[model samples]
Target: MMGVVYTTFMDMVAERFSEDVLDEVLDDPGLSTGGAFTSVGYYGHTDMIKLVVRLSQITKLPVDTLIEAFGEHLFGVLVGKYPTLAEGRSSSMELLEVVDTAIHVEVLKLYPNAELPEFRCERLEPSVLHMEYRSKRPFSRLALGLIQGCAKHYGETLEISHESFDSEEQYETHFTIKRIQ
Candidate 1:
């Protein structure tokens, strides 16, 4: 996983909870990096899972809830760091449609080793998008949060329904997103 993910998660913990809570989460003896992460470095995905588990224990929040919230926070951080990703995109669906082709391509240019999810999208209607998300990691809830964040960024309201499938090889999810008038 990218270190920027860890750094942003840590920042989210601090901002949404408190610096003290962040300190507690980092103090977990199970973390390989000891919660020290740099934006340009890479770390094990297990370390991230451990951090989220620890935070969930400390905050009494469900792991899925925390991951989803982190995803939303991550969207903001990414947008702030790479404004070009959202540049000239007037709608969430517009931005999401190019994620696999444009955004991930740019991400790969910077970090070829970064493992990103694959997305296939179809326009079901002018106000509706059908998307399939596939990844080795189990983060479909996180993807939902990212979609929500995207909608919020565009000042749009969306009705999103998700169906998921999990297999030994990968996790797959289908999302139906409809813009609310």
Candidate 2:
């Protein structure tokens, strides 16, 4: 994971929870980074997982929920940091369909060491999008939250359906998004 992710997560926690809770979570001995993170650095992916787990314990919210909320919050940070990516995109679906081909490509250029999820997308109908998300790490809720955030950002509403599966060999999720006017 990149430090930008950790920094956004820290910002989200501090805004939603207390700054003290963020401090306490970072203060835990298990984190190798000691909770000090910079947006331009790289950190172990496990560090983020540990922090989210600790935050979940403190807030009594599910870890997945926290991750999803963080994803929603992270989208705003991403837009603020990378406005060119959003420029010329008129709708949420327009932005989402190009995530793998455009946004992730730009992301890799900026943060070469970053590990990102794979999103296979298909436009099944004029207003419907079918997508499959695959990642070694489990963060489907986060992806869903991102999808919701994008729709909100574009001033659109969607009916989203999804399924998740985890086996020894793989973790995969399928999402069906239908734009609603």
Candidate 3:
């Protein structure tokens, strides 16, 4: 994975908690990167996973909740870093429809080695969307946060329901998003 993600994850922690808390998470022995991450570098995703787990323990919050919050923070970072991605987009659904085609495509161009989750999105109605998220990493909460963040960014309201397909080997999940009228 790209180091930018790890950097953003750390930034999220620092912003939500404190730099001291971030340092504590990084100082843990579980991180392979030794808590040093750069936006232009590359590292193992496992390192990030360890960091998140540590943060969860420190904050006494669910791992998924922390990850979702990180995802929301990352969305804001993306908006700041790549304003063009949101250009001409008026709603979360509109931007989401093009995430793989437009956003991920651009991310691959910039960081070819980055492993991103696959999203299959269908507009069930004008205001309802059904999306399936599949990833090797267990980071669905991050995706949830990003979806929520998008709605917040677009000044829209939504109700999100999700079910996870958990097994011994992999993770798959479905999200039902209904834009509140």
Cα RMSD of all models vs. native, in order, equals 1.1, 1.2, 1.4
Q: What is the lDDT of residue 161 in candidate 2?
A: 97
Q: Candidate 1, after superposition: displacement of residue 15 in Å?
A: 1.0
Give the TM-scores of the predictions, in the order they appear. 0.96, 0.94, 0.94
Per-residue lDDT of candidate 3, residues 125-177 (tens digit): 99999998888888788899999889888888989999999677767889999
CA error at residue 168 for candidate 3, angstroms: 5.1
lDDT of each: 0.90, 0.88, 0.87
Local lDDT at 3 for model 3 = 76
Screening candidate 1 with a backbone cut-off below 3 angstroms (N, C-alpha, C), the clashing residue pairs are: none
* Local distance difference test, candidate 2: 0.88
Off by over 4 Å in 2: none
* Top candidate (lDDT): 1
* Candidate 2, poorest ten consecutive residues by summed lDDT: 163-172
Model 2: clashing residue pairs? none
Best of the two (1, 3) by TM-score: 1
Return the clash pairs for model 3, or none. Answer: none
TM-score leader: 1
Model 3 residue 50 lDDT score:
88
